[model samples]
Target: GLLPAMALLARTLALLAMTLAITAIKVVPLDMARDSFDDQYRGCSPAMMAVLPALHNFEFQVNPLFTQTWVKAEAEWRKRGSPVSPLASPAQAVALMAYTTKDIYKDFNAAVRVAGHSRQEYRNNFHFKTLHFLLTKQCHHVFRGVHDVRFQARRGQKVRFGQFTSTSLSKEVAQKYGTDTIFEVQTCHGVDIQAFSFYLSNQEVLIPPYETFKAVLETNDIGVALFLNLVLFFVHSLDHLGFPKLLPLSPHWKVSSVSPGLNVIVHSSGSFTIL
Candidate 1:
């Protein structure tokens, strides 16, 4: 199992390097990723302005996650008295909103434009945004801004050391079980901690205003949304079963109840096909 994990990790790095090797072969243009950003409005936060535009560039980083930083973040989180693991996810978005304090609404207007909400109370409390700033606090949290894909993948990597014995289980059984196969596809995640305003209207240019600071995210919502939708849609459209149900459990990972197949895509479109 470790072998597969390690090999997969290697493949990821290789894919990234490959992309950088031949950037000219890109499929989607930049316009889709950076939609809605106007040229005249620069991102209000200096940190965001620098990082958001370069989401595709792995080399550039205004913030990086390292041991020292994560230690500081955990400490600060403790200081803030945040829950051990925040109860926030797409499914529990309502719960996340309930946990939202009044302070997150400081820049209500900025949030409304990007998100379609203006009211302070029901306004969108981006788990992605709040989590972003929380990590960037003075405490020097280890996690970098949401803009870094490598940083996020590192955070998501799990090295479990318990018994992971797989029963000959079933080449037949596994294949049969997947009869209900619901999903199979690639996944890519990119985070830009600084969600800058390429073009902010006169009203939004004002900081501390509701318009200037849109709610922050725990990760890059735009990228995640795009990545998941792209992959899920691609896989689900072909399968008769509707999209895989979101596992009632596991907020940190994407869960799809799909039949297992030879094709599997890991983080950043790094995939392996058994056939």
Candidate 2:
């Protein structure tokens, strides 16, 4: 009689060899994924999601004791501040200059005409909208007594950045010049408040369907590799009793047209079944 036990022995050997030959291995870790620089150490730390019954704390923790070094010189800027053609904060200049004119609306129209020559989009967007909201929402008590100021930026027109920007801004500067709550909610991760400012001003609009490519990756990345590995593991299972791949991704295998059941006893070593 053909030995049913012997065939099981062969399949286990093949599986073990493949698992051992894999090129990379990694373990998933919990991380907080903080969104801004203003976040403080007292709050934004990572912890496991599972809730336990009682209060708990761990005393001993390992620290590698690594430190970073930097020169006294200015750090690299994320977004340039000085006047640049077209994009040199057309909105801010317009907003400020608009204040000096008797007819605010007429003054802004003229300012846009002057500034729009550089970059109509910036003139159109006006300081990315940060300082615009500073005027609205009663950002500071100082605005109350300043002047009877009235301004407008069209919110209708569409643009690539709903609030997102190709530009990056420092969290330090954003906090100083703009409201922390406004920028924190509107801005994306890393420095760059230009998009948020533009959005609030209603001058520029975010590109439709902008999120589809936000963090797109090529086939070479580690996340892709891990997914491919799982695919290989399932496709190569020649064993008659091995569980099907679909069953793992979904547990509703019993209702499906084709679903392989489990085998808990098969393990392979050299020539004999190891488990």
Candidate 3:
């Protein structure tokens, strides 16, 4: 009986990885999509222990294609004297891909909103926690002065962007999402991923999922005010009942502008980062 249960769990994980890989390149309508890929595996039951291994399997299946394309992009950026974010390690790239592309088959913008909101309860989720660690730790550098665009009109809300959200060095890309109503977001924790996203041109800066921001500034522009928010990044040292410690941030290394485009970034790292 126990062996059969284990086999079933294995099958479930494999199915999940395969479906995610399909969504990576397929196109689906927003009306037919789930909020987040992780929604199906939220509660931490005993079988939930298999999630990390499943993520590892996902990475292994996808890394060859990702790295083959990414290495060329990394070299190109290096030649241009604008290197990719140090946080865009091979493993981290896959994590971001899983989260960002999970709903890519649906409407991209709607996918982002749903994924970010759905991740609010993922603090205990092994996939997200590993992603958090990769962005906050392991990379050895702190990110500051990143920008993003949101379609929502959250002028006075205390916001917790609950997933690996994409930001950028270029305001032009942020401005593209809105015509009359736009929410311009400025924060301090973003990793440059132009290298990892070889197929994209946007100088993508990714905000880690483990921080809090309070909308502090709103301009008088016609439905196009800049919502500059100060962000504080923190890390949990223990799993259960652990206090959060604020991560150190650098005053420098903020990119003001880059080549223009738009892209959404999200997801988790590999087995090494997973518990």
Best by lDDT: 3
Where is model 3 more than 4 Å wrong at Cα?
A: 1-55, 58-89, 94-157, 218-275
User: What is candidate 2's lDDT per residue for 105-124, written digit by digit as tens?
Assistant: 23223332232222233223
**After best superposition, candidate 3 residue 68: deviation in angstroms?**
15
| Selected candidate, larger lDDT, 2 vs 3 | 3
Candidate 1 differs from the real structure by a C-alpha RMSD in angstroms, to one decimal, of: 25.4
Residue 47, candidate 2: alpha-carbon lDDT = 15
Per-candidate TM-scores read 0.16, 0.15, 0.40
Query: In model 3, what lDDT does residue 63 have?
Result: 43
lDDT per residue, candidate 3, 1-275, as tens digits?
99999999999999998666444432211111223322211133223333435433544354443333334444544555553355444445554443344333123233333442232322222223333333332221222232222223234545544445565556566555432323344555555565655336556666644434554553342222334444343321112221233222233211111001101111232222111
- Order the candidate numbers by lDDT, best to worst: 3, 1, 2
Ten-residue region with minimum lDDT total, candidate 2: 65-74
